[model samples]
Target: MDRPLVAVGSVIFNGDSVLLIRRLHPPNQYKWAIPGGKVELGERLRDAVIRETLEETGLLVEPRTLMGIIEVFKEGYHYVILDFICEKKGGELKASSDAGDAKYFTLNEIRKLNVSSTTLEMLERFWRGEKMPFMITEISK
Candidate 1:
């Protein structure tokens, strides 16, 4: 059996808007989601979130809260994703690396986009200012 891949994602906020990326690859390709990606070996979770966010959105962010954890299983791939709420520290907004596009969006604006269900749920909870406990999920193959 293979170990599940570990990933990190961030809900990075700038004022009343949140940063989002249009994925350039599979597993919801072309869909809008928070900036993040797989955690490299030996990387800390917080560090991974920051690095992934920077790589995808060109923004330096500070992870403020551990919002939740979600397990995604599809086909033969399994991933454990750590989700964080982050504050922008610096850097310009430009899509690069794993993202096709990146931008900030208000909650209402976000609802108009094509997004993953998990991402939508997370955003809704975030907009409500709900304190989330750690969560785990397995996507049926």
Candidate 2:
């Protein structure tokens, strides 16, 4: 068995609303999610999220603290994610090729927003504001 043990993610927030970006890529089209992606080789964790956010949303952000980490397993593959709490640092709002759209939304909106199961779960846990130990789980059958 092989485990895919590498990836990064973020939970960018604007006051009560968290920023969600629509994936412009295949498979996740029209679906919403936090602005993040996989960690590149030799890239720092924070730097990877920062870079991914800018590339996806065109907004520079300074990540604060790592909120949580998730391990999703399905079909013999593992997805390791680092969910960070970040704030806008600079740059005018612009959507890029990776993200079809970007905007902030309240937690309630998140409940109504269409997103990947992992993304939605991460958002809900983040909204609670509890300092939690990095949560790790395997989404399996």
> lDDT values of the candidates?
0.85, 0.77
Q: What are the per-residue Cα lDDT tens digits for candidate 1 across 1-141?
A: 379998889888778888889998866789998889999989998899889988898889999988878788865778888889888899898999989999888888888999877777777876787786557575866
Question: At residue 44, what lDDT does model 1 achieve?
Answer: 94
Predict model 1's lDDT versus the native. 0.85
Measured by TM-score, how close is model 2 to the native structure? 0.84
The regions of model 1 sitting more than 4 angstroms off are 136-140
User: What's the C-alpha lDDT at position 42 in model 1?
Assistant: 92
Q: Which candidate number has the best TM-score?
A: 1
- C-alpha RMSD for every candidate: 1.7, 2.4
**Tens-digit lDDT track for model 2 on 1-141?**
454766666677667788888887733458897788878789998899889988888888887888887777755567777888887889877779689898888878877878777777766765666577467575756
Estimate candidate 2's alpha-carbon lDDT, on a 0 to 1 scale: 0.77
In model 2, the clashing pairs are: none
Cα distance off (Å), candidate 2, residue 117: 2.1
